[model samples]
Target: MTFNAVTFTVFLVLIAVVTVMGFVASRWRRAKQADRLDEWALGGRTFGPFVTWFLLGGDLYSAYTLIAVPAAIFSMGAFGFYAVPNAIVLYALGFLFLPKLVSLAHKKGYVTLTDFVNDRFGSKALSLAITITGLLATLPYLALQLVGLEVVFGALGIGGSGSWFVRDLPLLIAFGVLAAYTYSAGLRAPALIAFVKDGLTYLVVIAAVIWVPIKLGGFGEIFRKGGAALAGKTTSTLDPAIAVNPSVYLTLALGSGMAFFLYPHAITGVFASRGAKTVRRNMSVLPIYTVLLGFVALLGMMALAMGVKPHDGNPQYAVPQLLSAVFPPWLTGVAYAAIAMSALVPAAIMAIAAGNLVSRNLYRQYRTKPVSAKSETLVSKVVSVLVKVGALVFVLTLDAKFALNFQLLGGIWILQTLPTVLFGLFTKRFADRRALLAGLLVSVVYGTWAAYQVKSATGGPFGGSTAKPFFLDSPIYIAISALALNFAVVVLGSVLARALGAHPRAAGVAEEPVAASN
Candidate 1:
C-alpha cells in the first residue's frame, strides 16, 4: 500500500492536538495532593457524571471496538455480532453490581480491584494472586490497542510494507507519546482525551454509516454485494441462511459480560467516579456506545461491498482500508485519527491500571519497609511507562492475532478471580483464601488447555478461545466453562476447608460510609 501524504498530515495534526490535551488534563481537576495514589490514579475520585460517562465510554468501547470488532465481523460474518450482546449484557451487569463496587471501593479507599479483594479476604497472598492475574490479563488488552493503532498507521500507508524497524517506528513513536502524557497526567490524561476520541469517533462513524451505504447503492445492495463477495468462504457464513451456533454466541455474551468489570482498567474507571450514583448513571448511558458499536461492526460488510480486502491478509486493516477507499483523503485521515486515539486512550488507562496493581498490591505488600503514599504514586507512574513499553514489545514481536487471542485468554484468567472478588462481596462463606486459590488454579489450567486445543481460523493451535468440550457439536466460550469450573472448585474447596477448621479473617481496616452524591 502506498502512503498518502494528505491523510498522514491530517492524522498528525489531530494526534498533536490530542497530545496537548493529554498534558493539560493534569490541571483539569488538579488535586492539592496530586502525588497521592488516589489523586494520581483515580482523578481524585472526583469525576462527575459527564466526565465519568465519557471516561467509562472510552475505557469500554476501546480500540478493539474500532479495529478488532470490525475485523471479526469482516472475517467471520454473523458470528462477530456477538460483540453487540456482549456489550449490552456488560452494562446490564454493571447496573446491578457497579454501584455496590463503587461504594465499597470508596468506603475502603481502594485503588484497584486487588485492593478490594485483599481487604475483603484479609489475605495478602490472595491480593497477590489477583494482582498477577490482572497484570497478565491486561498485557494483551494493551497490546490490542497497539494493534488498533498499527491498523490506522497501515491505513495512512505509514508502515504497511517495510523493514521490521521501519514498519514499527510509527507505533513506537505513538507509544512514547502515550507513555509521557500518562506518566505526567495519570488517569486524567485518558479522561480528558476520551472526549476527543469519542467525539471524532461519533462523527466519523455517523458519516460512514450514511455515506458508505449510499455509495454502495443502498443497504440492500450493500448486503447483496457483501454476501456475494463472501460466497463460498467457509468463515463467511454471515447471513440467516447460515444459522449461527447458539451455544457459542450465548456463552460468549454471558462470559464476556461477567468478565467486563473484572478487567483492571474497567475497575479503575469505576473507581474514578465521585459517587455510587455516578457509576449507576454512567451504566445507564454507556449503551449509547454499544449502539455505535453495532454500526461499527457493519463497516465490515461495507468493506466487502467496496471490495476492500486488507493488505497482507490482515483483517484488522479491513475497516481502515474501506474508509480510505470510500472517503476523501482528508475525512479518511480524520477517521484514522479517531481510530488511533481510541487505541491511545485505552492503552494509557490499561497501563495505569496494571501499574496500580503492581505498585499497590504487589510492591506495597512485599516491600520490607513501609512506603509513603507519594512514593507509591511515583512508582506507579514509572511502572505505567514500563508497562506500555512491554506491550509495545509484544506488538512488535508477535502476530497481531496472538494479541486478540490472548485478550480472550485474558478474559478467561480474569474471570477466575470472580469467585474471590465478586462472590466474596456478597457472601462470607467463600472468604477462605485457599479456596479462592484452588478455584483460580483450576480455572487457569483448564482454560489454558481448552484454549490450546482450539485452532485458529487463520492458522495454528491456541488461535481461538472457543472450544467444543466433551465433543459437543456447538462450541462454547472457554471462559464460561472456566468460570463454571472455578465456581465448583470454590464451593467444594470452601466446604472442605471448613471441615478442616479453617476460619475467616477480619478485614483490618474500618469501612466508612460513602456519600451518595458527587
Candidate 2:
C-alpha cells in the first residue's frame, strides 16, 4: 500500500498548518499576565466549555485509543470492548467528582493535583510521593503515544528500512513539533489543536464504519466471514482471566473507574477548564464518543473478516491495516496523518503534565524561599523535553512489546497514590505520612512481583496473567487497594507513635497562599 508523493505532501502540509495554529493559541489569555504559572501551564485556567471538551477528550482518548483499542479488538475479540466501557466509566467517575475538584481548584488556585494533596494532607513528603508517582506513571503513557504515531508512519512506509534511525524518523519529526509548540504555548497549544485531532478522528472512524460494510458484502456477512475465520466465533466476548464472572467485571470496572480521574494527567485536563461550568458541561457531553468507540471496536471484526495480520513487531498496527485496505491511497494517507497527529497531541500533554510534577515538587522540595513562577515554568519545559527524548529512545532502540508491559506495571505503581489523593480531597483525617509510604512500598512490591510472574512460553513475551487469585490481570490499577494497605499501616504506626509520644511537626502550615503563586 504505497502512498503517492502527493498524498504524503498534503499530509505534511496539514500537520504544518495545525502546528502553527497550535503555537498561535498561546495568546488565548484572559489577562496581560505573562509570569504566572497558571497562565503558562494551565492555559490561564480559562478554557471555556467547548475548548475544555476538546482538550480533555483529546488528552483522554489519545493515540492509545486511536490505534491500541482497535488493534486489541482485532486481535482478541470482545475483550477490546473494555476500552469503550472504560471510557464510559471514566466520564461517570468524572461527573461525580470533577465539579467539586473544579470548585476547589478555582477557589484555591491549584495547578496540579499534587497541590491539592499537599494542601489537604499537610505533608510535603506525601505530596512529593504522589508527584513522583504521577511523573513515573506517565512515561510509558507518553511512549504509548509515540508508539501510536510509529504505527501510522510504518503504514505509510515513510521510512523504508527497519533500521533504528529510519524507522524512528517520523517519530522524531512528530516529537520535535510536539515539543516545540508545547514548550512555547503550554497547554493551550494542545487544547487548540485537539479541535483538529478530534474532527479528523471522527471523520476517519465514521468513514470506516459506513464504508467498510459496503466495500465488503455487509455487516452480517462480514461477521460471518470473521466467525468462520475464528472457528465459528464472530467475536469472542470477555477476557477469561479478568472478565470471568460478574464480580470480576464489577471489580475491574469499578476499580478502574475510581482510578481514571485520579491520575495527575487526568487532573491536568480538569484544571485546564476555565470553571466548574465548563467541566460539568464537558462531562455531560463527552459520552457522545461512546458511539464512536463502539464503531472502532467493531473494526476488529472487520479486520477478522479481512484476515488482517499484525504489523512487524507492533500489534498496534491492526487498525491502520484495516483502514489502508478499505480507503483509497489519498484518503489512506489522510487517515495515517490523523493517527500520527493523534499521538502527537497527547504525547505533548503527558510530557507537560509529568514535567509539572518534577518542576513543582522535586526541584523545590528542599528550597526554603520557594521557587519563582518563571523558574518553575522553566524547569517544567526543560524536563518535558528530556522525558520525550527518553521515551523516544525507548521507542527506537528497545522492544515495544516489553515497553507496553512496563507501562502496565506503571499503572499498578501509580494506583498506589490514590488513597493519599482522592480521599484526601475532601478529608484530612487519613493524612498519616508513614502509613502512606508503607502502602506505596507494599503495592509497588506486590504489583512488580505479579507483573514479573507473567513469563510467556517458548521464551518470548510474558503472557501468564495479571490476576493473582482474588485480583485481576490489571494489577497495576490496584492503587486503591494499595491505598487501603497504606492507610492501615499509617493508622497502626500513628497509634504506636502516639503511645510513645513521638510526632513529626505539622507541614504545609507556613506555605504561602495558593492564590499568591498564581
Candidate 3:
C-alpha cells in the first residue's frame, strides 16, 4: 500500500490532539496528593460512571482485539467469533461479583489486585504469586497492542524501509508519545484518551458496518460468497453454517470470560471507580464495545465478500486494507488513527497497572526498609517505562503471530491466579493460602505445557490457544482446561489443609470494615 498524503495528515492531526489530551489528563481529575501511588497509579480511585465507561472500554477492547478478531474472522471464518462470547460471561461476572470486590477495595484502599489478595488471605506469598503472574501475562499483551499500531503504520506507508531503526522509527515515535503522556498523567492519561480512542473507533466501525457491506453488495451477498469461500477441509468448523466442535467454542468463551477481568488493567479500572455503582454502570454499558466488536468482526466476512486480497497474504492487514480501499483518504485517516489510538490507551493503562503490581505487591510488600508513597509511586513509574521497553523487545525480536499468542500465553499464566485472587473473594472455602499457592504453581506449569503442545500450521509451539486435550475428543482452550486442573488441586489441597489443621497464616495487617464477607 502506497502512502496517501491526505490520510497521513488527518491521522497525525488526530494523534496530536490525543497526545495533548494525554498530557492534560493530570489535571482532569487532579488529586490533592498527585505524586502518591493511589492518585497516580489509580486516578485517585475517583472515576464516575461516564469516564469509567470509556476507560474500561478502551482498556479491555483494545487495538489487539479490534485488529486480531477481524483478522481471525477474515482468514479462518466463523471460528473467530470464539473471542466474542467472552463478553457475556465477563459482564455477568462483573455485574454480580466484581462490585463485591469493588466495595472491599474501597474500604481497604487497595490499588492492585494483589493488595486485595494479601489482605483477604493474609499472605504476602500469595500476593507475590499474583503479582508475578500479572507482570508476565501483561507484558506480552502490551506488545500485541504495538502490533495493532504497526498495522496503522503499514496502511499509511510510514515505514518499511531503511535499517531496522528506520523501518520502526514511526513506532518508536509513537512509543515516545505514549510514554510521555503516560508518565506525565499516569492512569488519567489513558482514561482521558480513551474517550478519543473509543469515539473514533465507534465512528469508524459504524461507518464500516454500514458502508463495507453495501460495497460488498449487502449482507446476503456477503454470506452467500462468504459461505462458499469459508468451507473447512476437516471438522474444524471453518464455515459459518457449521458450529461443530461446539465444545471448543464454549470452553474458549468461558475461559476468556473468566480470565478477562483477571488482567491487571481490568482490576485497575475497577479500583479506579468511585463506587460499586460506577462499576455496575460501566459493566452494563461495557458490552456496547462488544456489540461494536461483533460488527468489527463482520469486516472479515465483508472482506471475503468483496474478494479483498491481503497484502503479502497477512490477514492482519485485512481490515486496514479494506478500510483504505473502501473509504476515501480522509475517512481512511480517521480509521487508521482510531486503530492506532486504541493501542495507546490500553498500553498506558497496562503499564501503570503492572507498575502498581510491582511497587505495591512485589517490591513494596517485601521491602526491609520503609518506602514513602512518593517513592513507591516513583518506583512504579520507572517500572512502567521498563515494562514497555521489554514489550518492544518482544515485538522487534519475535514473529507477531507468536507475539499474538503472547496474550493467550499470558492468559494461560494469568488464569492460574484465579483460584487465588478471585475465588477467595466469595467464600473462605478456597482460602487456604498454601493450597492456593500450589494451585497457582501447578496450573502455570500444566497450562504452559498444554499450550506448548499446540503446533500451528504456521506458528510453532505456543502456536495457538486451542488444542486437543488428552482426554477430550475436541480441542479446548488451554486456559479453561488448565483452570479445571487448577480448581481441582486447590479444592483437594484445601480439604487436606483443613484435615491436617493447617490454616492461612495471618500477616497481622489491620483491616477496614465494609460489607460483610463469608
Candidate 4:
C-alpha cells in the first residue's frame, strides 16, 4: 500500500479541527454548575431531539459497526448480515423500552444504571454486580473501537513500523487527544464531535455506494462478479446460508437485539437525552443509520467485485483497500477519518459511562466520609482516562482478529443484567434483589464458561458466542441460554428466600433522587 502525503495531511487537519471543537464544547451549552455530575456526565441532560439523534447514532454505530461488520461480510459472507437485522431489531426494542428507562433515570437522578439498581433494590450487592459486569464488558468494547482505529490507520499507511510502541504511536496519539478533550469537556466533547462524525459517515457511505458500484460497472455487475467469486461457498455472500445450525442464527440475532441496550454506554445515551420524548423521537428515526449500515455492509461485496485483494490475507483490510482502489486519495482520507472518528464517539461514551459507574457505584461506596461533587467529577475524569489506556493496552497486546468477537463476548457478560435493567423498568418487585444478584452471578459465569468451551473453525476456545448446551440439540446463542438460567434462578431462589423469611433490602423502590447532593 502506497502512502499519500496529502491524504495524511487532510486526515490530520480533520482530527485537529475535531479536537479543538471538543474542547470548545464544554462551553457549548455553558451550564452554571459545570463540575456537577449531571452537567459533566450527562451534558446537563438538555440535548434536544436533533442533537440526541446524532449522539445516539454516533454512540450506537462505532468503528466496529463500520469496520468489523463489512470485514465479517468479506470473510464470512451471509452470516455477517446479522449486523443489519440485529440493528433493526435493536431499534424496535429500544423504541419500546428506552423511553421508560430514560424517564426513570432522569426522574430519579441516576447517572449510571447501577444508581438505579441501588435505588430500586436498595442493595449494594446488586449494584456492585451491575457495575462490575458493565466495566468488564465495556473494556473489550473499548478495545474493539481501538481495533477500528488501527484498521483505518493501517489503511492510510500510517501504521508505523518498528517496535510495538512505535508501531501504535499514531493510534496512541489520537487516543491521547481524545482523552484530553473528553476529560476536559466530559460528555459534551463527544456530543459535539458526533455531528462531524455522523456527517462524514453519511458522505462516505453514500459515496462508496455510488462510486464503488460505478467503478465496478454498477450494482448488477458488482453482484454478478461478487457472486461468481463467492460461488459454491455455501457460507458465501447471497447464499442466505448462515451456518449448519438454523436455530443458532435466529437465537444469535434475537439475543443480539435484546442485549444491545443493556450495555451501560447505551443506557448512558438514554440518560443524556432531554426527556423521554426525545428518546422516543430519536428511536423513531434512528433507523436512518441502520439503512446506512446496510449500504456499508455491501462495500464488502463491492470489494469482491472490484477484485480488491486484502493486505496480508486479512479481510478486515478489505473496505480500506476498496476505498483506496476506487476513490481519489483525498476522498479516501476523508473516508478513513470518518471511520476513525466513529471509534471516538462510542469510545468516549463507553469511557464516560464506565467512569460514572466507578465514581458513583464503586468509589462512592468505599469512602469513609461523603464524597464531594467536585471530587466525584474529578474521579470520573481520571477513571475515563484509565479506561482508555486500558483499552489501548488491550488492543496493542491481543490479536486484532480477536476483536471480531469482542461485541459478542461483551454481550455474553452484559446480557446477565437484563433481568435487572430490562425487568426492573416495568416493576420494582419481580423478585428479591438478592435472588437477582445471585442470578447475575450465575449467568455471567455460566455464559462465559459455555462460550469458552465452544471451539472455532480454527479449533480454539472462545471461538464464538453460539454454543450447544445439553438441553438443546443444536447450538443456540449462549446469551439466550444464560438468560434462561438467570430467570430460573431468580424465580426459584426468590421462592426459597421467601420461605426462609429472607426479605429484600427494601420493600418498595425509593422515590427520592439517588444522586448525592451537589
Candidate 1 yields a Cα-based lDDT of: 0.84
| RMSD to the hidden true structure, all candidates | 2.8, 4.0, 2.8, 3.2
Judged by whole-model lDDT over C-alpha atoms, candidate 2 comes out at 0.72
lDDT string, candidate 1, 260-291, tens digits: 88899999999999988989888898898888
Q: Please write out the lDDT profile of model 3 over residues 173-247, one tens digit for every residue.
A: 999888888888999999999998988999999999899777777899998887777663232423223344687
- Models 1 onward score TM values of 0.94, 0.88, 0.94, 0.94
How many times do residue backbones clash in model 2?
A: 6
* Candidate 2 lDDT by residue in tens digits, 1-518: 35567667767877887899778977766347766767777888888888888888788778778777777666656655777777788788787667877777888878788877776656766777777778777898888788777777777768757786775677788888888888888888888888998898899889998999998899999888876765643333223445334444454555555666766677888897877777878889998987888887888888888887767634577778888788876777678777777787788888888888887777765668778888888888898889999998887777776667667666767767665654555443433555666667777676666556554321435332244434443433343445456566656765665565544434222222222112
**Model 3: lowest-lDDT 10 consecutive positions:** 233-242
Give the better candidate number (2 or 3) by TM-score: 3
Q: Which residue pairs show backbone clashes in model 3?
A: none
- Model 4 regions lying over 4 Å from their true place: 232-244, 402-407, 456-458, 499-518
Q: Which pairs in model 1 have colliding backbones?
A: none
